[model samples]
Target: MLYPPLHHWLLGAVGEGRLNWLMLLLAAPVQFGPGLRFYRTGWAALRHRSPDMNTLVMLGTSAAFAYSLAVTLAPQLFPAGSRHVYFEASAVVITLILLGKLFEAIAKGRSSEAMRTLLQLQPATARVQRGAQVQEVPVDAVRLGDLVLVRSGERLPVDGEVVEGRSYVDESMLSGESVPVLKESGANVTGGTVNGTGAFTFRATGVGADMALSRIIRMVEDAQSSRPPIQGLADRVVADFVPLVLAIALVTFLAWLLVGGEAALTNALIHAVAVLIIACPCAMGLATPVSIMVGSGRAAQMGVLFRSGAALEELGEAQVVALDKTGTVTQGQPEVTDVFVDRGWSVVDGEQHLLRLAAAAEASSEHPLARAIERAAAPSPITRQPPSRRSLATAFAPSWTATRLRSARRGSWRG
Candidate 1:
């Protein structure tokens, strides 16, 4: 097609004197075919007295094509020394522009994939119970107050309150918390959260467009569509840039022709064409997209993810960053220095069970405090039926008390 093959052929055909006929053939298809899009847009801009990068590109390529065609057809009009054709210059510029836009599209797609990954977090289907009969249904079919059964390790498809059973839910995707939050009867649960090793039944409180996940997706889309503050400056520059470039090109043409003697006409046209090509709106127009793309790419590499292109742009202006003290600035090498248990728990002597539960709870945490708890509980050597480690410390820090924290942080205990 005009995309992949056009660039390859044009690049290789550059400076090939013997293939002028083939170059002419290839160049004709480009200027008349894909190049027509630029001409139409450029001509419209000209008619309206508003030129753009398209105008610059169109004028440059057109001049190159016309000059080369004239040289090819009427060799007698020019001396043998001035008989140079630039079919490659015109074709290659368009091909390069196409190539740049293609790469830009691919980059933007990748940048926006964070939202796709988030959307995929919601389960495609849910086990819903209506009276005595339970049936599998698409997540969209789930309605408010419906009894949705979330199995161990399954994702909850709707925001709801737990009606029966107990489980730990992983809300990392939604809130960036590395630990799973515990859920029991009367506790509210969110959609897109991963159920821990325990199954649970919850009455759906929010469904369809009202769900937390749906809201998140909508916010991300809105952010993506929103323009950054700097976009105003870029727009203003683009508004006047084309006309200014045209003036410069005209001055360059006149200057060369008026100053040079014998080869002034040919020299003037070359300077004017050079001005047009050099001033192509590519870089100026790309200021915003390129910055956003580059910012996204660089941030992603550093384990930082942005919600959208607009967010990335706005982040550049942020003078302060908030981070967790236990892990962000320090070595995060917390050690469980003291263990405090409640009086009732002490009377029962539940240290063995305590250690097992503690070990399982803190394993999923990236923070140093959780690591300390995990380390202290690892030596307990007790086992239970939870199947694997849990992220309870980082998970329950917001709601669970110190006693509950110690109980879950000591060992791999389960009921």
Candidate 2:
């Protein structure tokens, strides 16, 4: 492909004089542009007390440039035209190295879509209940203890407890569950989950960077920033390999000049530059970043977000998996299977009367228990009352009579 055969094309270009002037003209810009990034990165790694692939590519390409420059300007310094220029080899190596870097960047950009998706989940504004008045305001302007009112079809804008109403919340964005979970007063809700069925007012306990969704996003960003362990090996090899190859090439040229004369010296110098160009270490530098990008993108599709290269690497060796009980092990739903009351609290008439009162209290609510109550009371005669100030208050009051009145208002009361 474009990679494994790069060295052969480089060698061929040098053997033909097609690349000489072109190589000299393009060398500085290519070296300073794409090549310089590696050079600087390697230098930073070294200063940080670490070595990396850039260190090797930089040293090797620099050697090739110096040697080719020497042969180009002063042909007689080595032997009678014995020092041949391998300008094409240097140019081709730098070009291929840059291509590999571009590929790595493209791959990483693709993997970062997970972060973009997470950012898109945030709601821009929230309806806050300031006493009896509700106002739409910027989400960032919201604070802890603020009572945020979420209407049907609106996204919950902060992590908080449902304080004033009941609703079914679509929590798939945060929990990965497909069902709409019913939430009520004292139930916890997260920012970005969609409110379903009814309006609700929740106390804003978490906002800004402290929200659950924001924390998950931060974790993924941190994961993307972390370096994998295998990159260290490639770095060490590149660092030592570059200068060592240059020294060997120099020795090869001197040995050829002393033992085999002018013709052999020319061949040796060309081969020496070939060695530096062929061993540029671009592939080594590309290996880790490309794999990390591919792995992270695939993980996102699977709904398993990886926050770092180290986390993904660690998962590869994991022997056991831990799952949260609420959403993972059990269905996050409540069903009213049965109900009983103490003799003193029981209706004087019998079981049907108590059932009618309990079902009535929950009829107008969108809670899971309300749905179950409505379903269970289906056989009874029910009537829907007009919504009025008295009816709304009677629906939410704590007394049994009020409960019966609310159920009657919702048409769940049995005559």
Candidate 3:
């Protein structure tokens, strides 16, 4: 039978004069089965010199059991059969508390799985270039200065600096920005970002657990383990509340025996037991877990992932806001602002010359300034050698060449 039904049977027997060894034997499993873990965990916490809500429940339930056992076995020790035992009430309270804990465990397990999904995005293997040979190896085996190859549609496996070639990198996984970023030599690439439309070689700067994705995972994990202030308050209340309730119950029992006489003793004991069973901190214990589940699930749907209950709580209280200057506040894309020329420079001739110079200098660059130069020179038709054939002398002809070289860089632009 279920705990509630069995508890009713045991309670009825105890209320009448039929308390027996068989009833106690049957009730023992019902009391201890669901609650055994709480006792074990509470004992372990105490052994380790820590106290928790489990400790309060353990002490309260143990007190109830000991008192009821004394009353059941030896009624004369408690002013004849006038006063009553509430072993069933104690058992029911423990069962309810255990049920709450089971629900909490299930909720926490799902949250942990959400974090696991984030961790799984990190690629295990990376294509590394050693001298002139390229080989696929475990990402952890990659070291600093190793050249890692990333291709179109593949996730970058380590934080690195682009050393050869160019590609548009989709960094939405880390920055939440939708547009692809063009990366070339000296540009920083992060692990878990997708490469777009081009092949590139990058020098590894971070590997294994030191990668950007791993640090994000670590931040989430740390948030999950940290407790919020509300949880701390609930824990403090539970710690002292259980013992205070037990003391009240004791006083109630004594007051009934002394002031209200023997006839009122049974009624008074019943009231005390009822208070103990109803005031069990089950609802309070469940409060934080339920809020966390609902809040985290809502955040996931909105593309915001919280690493822990503490993070959720802190986010709710946050007032001062800091935004990344480039993407969060202003559009990261730059637009042409003005065109200025040296004194006595012809408007038409100077414009054409500046455009040519800008296009050539920025032909191999992937910076926002380079892209702006390319866009400004798009309408003009200009033929230039491929990036590989172009000498380094032509590529680094000062920042002014970007404006003049803009037209040549336009044809190769994909963004």
Best by TM-score: 1
- Model 3 over residues 1-415: C-alpha lDDT tens digits? 2577876787686654465354456557866877777789877865765646776666666656655766668766555534455566667667666665565566556566766877777788999989889999998899988999988789998899998999888787788665578899999999989887689999999987888888887877776667767889887776567667768888877776677664666556655665555566656666676676677666666557666666788888788877654554335455556666566443456665566566666777655567777777777753353343344334334443565467457765221
Q: Which candidate, 1 or 3, has the higher lDDT?
A: 1
User: What lDDT tens digits, residue by residue, belong to model 2 across residues 62-118?
Assistant: 767877777666656666444555555555666766665666566556556877888
C-alpha displacement of 291 in model 2, angstroms?
2.0
By lDDT, is 2 or 3 better?
A: 2
Q: How well does candidate 2 score on lDDT at residue 285?
A: 54
lDDT of 1: 0.72
TM-scores, in order shown?
A: 0.69, 0.67, 0.66
Off by over 4 Å in 2: 1-19, 39-51, 76-84, 239-275, 301-304, 314-415
Model 2 gets an lDDT of 0.70
The candidate 1 region of ten consecutive residues with least summed lDDT is 387-396
Q: Which candidate has the top score in lDDT?
A: 1
lDDT string, candidate 1, 1-415, tens digits: 2597875576576643445666798899988888888899888987888765667778878878888887777766755677777787888777766665565565556646766877888889999999999999999899889999988789898999999998777776666665567899999999998887788899999998898988887876666566566665654665587778778989999998899688888778767876876766555445556666677667655546566555676677899988753234433244667676544442244564565666655555444455567677776773434323244433333434654656678773432
